[model samples]
Target: MKNVTSLASGAVTALVLSLGLAGGAAAEDFEWPRLLVIGTPGTSSGSFASTNGWGPILQKETGTTVRIVPEDSETQRYRRLTDREDIAISSVSASEMRYQIQGIDGYSQTKPVAQRILWHHNDTPWGYVVAGDSPVKSVQDIKNGGVRITQGVFSPPMVSAVTVGLPAMLGMSEDEVAEKIEFVPASSYAENCRSVVEGKSDIAYCSPISSVLSEMEGAPGSIRWLDLDPSDKEGWNAYLAERPMLIPAEIEMGVKTARGVNGATSNFVYSVPATADVDFAYNMAKWFHESFDAYKGTHPLATRMSMDQFRKYLNRTPLPVHEGTVKYLREIGQWSDEDDTWNNKAIETMDAWIAARQEALKAAQEQGIEVNFENQEFLDLMKEKTAGVENFQSRL
Candidate 1:
């Protein structure tokens, strides 16, 4: 009887161990991607340059190969993300994404879009630049002047705001701004900087770290960084009021290089969308977190990134956080009760916003009318459409 009992006990133990191994294998499973394409700017772009290192590291660590694909504008990347055309992730300016979602300014003609955010890397800042010899020293210097600023044709709305939002900050109407400001269109930041160098542009809008800015600052023009000084209360307040996305960021001040003068400018973070396969997203986040140390060594800008750096920007996230990322955050006890409340409220709000948007679209379609957000009737119609939606008040 004792021998028989021993045999039975050993069999049970073996079965339990086998089951545990199977569970572990499932947890460690990586979904082999057909293709993973990351949307980026041109090879020379600061945004895209970071990806050159990231692609190899991602492939090695996650067992998923990542392809670096260049795109000129956020709107262009938006199409791929919306279509889910093997585009696993892309880096876009958070401010521009917010602007696009609200369908404001140059983007007013397009319908509002909804996307998810995964991680926000804060390595880039945007602001106005000009020849150091130019007399345009401040925001006040541009008003009532014949200054032509080149707002890049393919520039993210965040970068382009310096030219347009400046007028709004100074309490001028859109028409007044249009009348006073001459906007020159260019194809790239490189061209925009050249405009400033060749005297075609008075002040240039640029990402401080771009090669174009560096090139001009080095050769074509020794540039001075222009910003709304914090000490100038009226100017600072007005700038903030006009451009909600402009946060006080410490930008690299350089005479075509790092001059070591700390200046305030607009900065943005790159994010991932929610439509990404949850398992893939979950594994991606987990892989990134586990390999955080190794990944940073991949590029110069990445040296600034950490797991906390990824989650810390959730406050300003214009869209919903990915479920996979949320899972990783929850596991680490990083996501809090406050986060839960906010996320729940946010999700409810977004759902109502989309549903109401669809309802309004249907009304317009049936009536064969255009739903202009600026029209009073459109506001009234939207109010009527969303009035019954749950948590509609919270969205307000």
Candidate 2:
């Protein structure tokens, strides 16, 4: 009887240990989807390269297949995200995300899409580019007059505002920029950059890693960048006043054309719509961070997508962080109480903006006013209606 009791106890202990070990293995092996789709910039872009770099590793490690779809502009990418169910994630600039969130500029005609950030991908320095031999040396030279700047005649209105609003960094008002700078018409973003290389325009906005810029660099005329001096504190303050979301980053990683220059760059990020599965978002965010070293060297810009950089700009992004990402951050002990406070405030601010816009739209409809961003009356009403909301500004 004593031997039988001892044998039963040993059997029970063995079964308990087996069950515990199996549970641990199950937790370690995350069940990833068979297929995951990612939308990004054009093939010639660094964003596309970075995404492609990690796509294979993600697939191999998690038993998931990754697909990349390249699109040219924010409008096209956002449209695909909303219209196509297959596109699970997309990349966008801070300005583009802000415009989409507020339903401003190109997004004015449609309702704002509820998007959340997965992580900060990279920061590409952007500034004006001119002919290599041009007399224009700094941003101030453009404000002094006689420079033909590209005015976007394209569908994306924020494209035009970005150029026009940049003068504010140098304490030049919109009216002054209008009076001093020659605004030339460019039908597309490619034309905007090529305008300078072709000698049709004196200056155009450029990112250092753009494939078009390499062409501009090798062109007969050559290309030169006009950097915004970071030492000028007042100028940056004014610049931030106009576009607070932008950051002054020293150019470290980009094409040869952009080396050794300081420029204003918005945080380029990867994000998904609010409708994304919480577990999917959480697992994806965790896996990417944990596997950062595997693909960080895939491209020049990919090296910049480190955990340090992601956390550095986490709180400053225009959109709120995804709930799943927040959960992962908490799990890893990376999240702090301060981050939680900031995130909640960001959510409240977004809610306020949406509510104000809705109220403004209803009032406009009742008053028979044209409810469009192009209409000054509608814009003014938005400002007036949202006046009480904290940190409410109609910026793009």
Which pairs of residues collide in model 2? none
TM per candidate comes to 0.63, 0.70
Per-residue lDDT for 134-167 in model 1, tens only? 8887766777767788877775663546565667
Cα deviation in Å at residue 188, candidate 1? Answer: 7.3
For candidate 2, what is the total of clashing residue pairs?
A: 0
**lDDT for each candidate structure:** 0.60, 0.71
TM-score, candidate 2, is 0.70
TM-score of decoy 1: 0.63
Ten contiguous residues with the weakest lDDT in model 2? 1-10
User: Where's the lowest-lDDT run of ten residues in candidate 1?
Assistant: 1-10
Model 1 lDDT, residue 120, Cα: 56
356 Cα displacement, candidate 1 (Å): 2.5
